[model samples]
Target: MKTDSQLQQDVMAELRWEPAVHATQIGVEVEDGVVTLAGEVSSHVEKWNAERAAQRVNGIRGLAVELEVKLGALDKRTDVDIAQSARNILSWTGSLPEDAVKVLVEQGWLTLSGEVEWQFQREDAAESLRSLPGLTGVSNQIGIKPSPSATVVKAEIEATLRRSAAADAKAIGVEVHGTSVTLTGAVHSWAERDSATRSAWGSPGVRKVIDKMSLVY
Candidate 1:
């Protein structure tokens, strides 16, 4: 097992390796296995990429991002313009339903609220708005509309996990209560853990997925 300092170095190196990130401007700190990213970037996309780069590193049990988006003068768009751009992008997104997402902008921060039939739709909406110029942050308040029938949530989730080819599918426990799922197990890497969580969320009628799984390495 790598020590906390070793893990911290690995994460810093990973950040530097990512082309989208300005690694020198970002500060990385590790305690135990948790990573905290602190600094300011020129764009929201850079901040998001930095977080993803850190999460890709092994031994990262948790991540707390304190990075801020410090937009330049040319990148600064009015709140009205940001809202229009957000709406336009959501409209152009083929996966999302028209008029399903409601946008509210305040001081360059955007908040999206609405209900979608699936989790992917909710995610897609936020992703479409993440790279918008002049945006300081995004809050995805969109929720999933529960299916009328949840009789087979547990079975379906298990089947999906198995189909995903997760390394420890059998070891992962799936517990369903109402439309919520709680996953418990130990995986060898972050990829397996994310796969298991996505499988749970993909299952129909799953409004919430609580990932209690941990990394064995």
Candidate 2:
């Protein structure tokens, strides 16, 4: 296991290596395995990139992001403009159905609410606006429409986990309650844990995923 100081250093180095994040404009602090990022970035994309870069560090167990977005004069846009642009972008995204997502922009923050059949579609709706100028943050409340039959959701998740190429697939346990799924197990790395969760979400009718899985490293 890496000490907190060592983990902090590795995270800092990762932030530097990531081209999207301005490492010098961000502060890193570690306690136990939790990393706290504080500072400011020029765009919402930079803040998101910094968070992703920190998560790529192996020993990081959690993140507390206090980074602020300071938009420049040219990057600033009215809430109405941002909302219109978001709507146009979502409409242009082939993966998302037209009018499937509702956008609300307030003080440069965008909140998305709607329903889709697949988890990937919900993700695609949010990813479509990550780099939009004048955006501060995004709250994706887009839901996955539950399957008609909940009885087979658990079984389908189990089959996928067993069939997936993930090395720890068999070690993970699946539990279903209505449209929600709970995954419990231990994996060798963050990658395996994420893969296991993704497999669970791939099932039909899984509106919420409770990941109880942990990293063994």
Candidate 3:
């Protein structure tokens, strides 16, 4: 069995390689298989990233997560604040109906799950969650499909891409079901692909953008 320090070091190593964690700080203390993370991060997303990073490394009794959040931004949130804000955002957003959605917070990270009407609701849910205090990241594992007009949804997605992407929204094919948009085809680079997705996400009614775009290596 690895010593606490050894396991902690391994966990840190894992976080260093993770693709998601940025714009924050992390500290660790280990005793036996128990791991505790300390320090202040900019967003709940980063905090969640740090914790998930620790879990992905393995060899731990449990996570004793002690993380502080930077105030003002939509990331740092207390448990009560997230619970209230979640209720508020979902109530206003009209994407996910009430009672169907749920939000859970641990150390400021907001975990969301439920059924929603539009794909954009899923994305909006993430955005709403991302803005709450102490929200490190949102686990948007929501399902879509309320069986509305698919054509109108696709047109809305295209219009949204036109407003946000600004480069080649016409070329970008959008398949929308409720609020979800699946973008298939090729783009110039990763940045462009992300930009396209951002456009879709920016739209008020859009929920999720499955960017299955390819780039030439």
Give one digit per residue, the lDDT tens place, for model 3 in 120-187. 66767777666565565567787654443668667665776677643467667777766677887766
Error of 3 at 51 (Å): 17
Model 1 misses residue 1 by how many Å?
Answer: 1.1
Query: How big is the positional error of residue 1 in model 2, measured in Å on the Cα after superposition?
Result: 0.5
lDDT of 2 by residue, 45-151 (tens): 99999998998889778899999999999999999999999999999999998899999999999999989998888889999999999999999999998674656
Q: Candidate 1: deviation at residue 168, Å?
A: 1.5
Distance from true location, Cα of 58 in model 2, Å: 0.7
Candidate 3 regions exceeding 4 Å error are 1-40, 45-81, 94-96, 146-184, 189-191, 195-210
Which residue runs does candidate 1 get wrong by more than 4 Å?
A: none
- Clashes in model 1: which pairs? none
Model 1 C-alpha lDDT per residue in residues 1-217, reported as the tens digit of each score: 8878998899899999999999999998888888999999999889999988998998888899999899999999999999999999999999998899999999999999988888888889999899899999999989888754555888888888878875577889998888788999889888899899888888755788898887898
> For candidate 3, what's the RMSD?
10.7
TM-score of each: 0.96, 0.96, 0.46
Error of 3 at 211 (Å): 3.8
Ranking 1 against 3 by lDDT, winner? 1
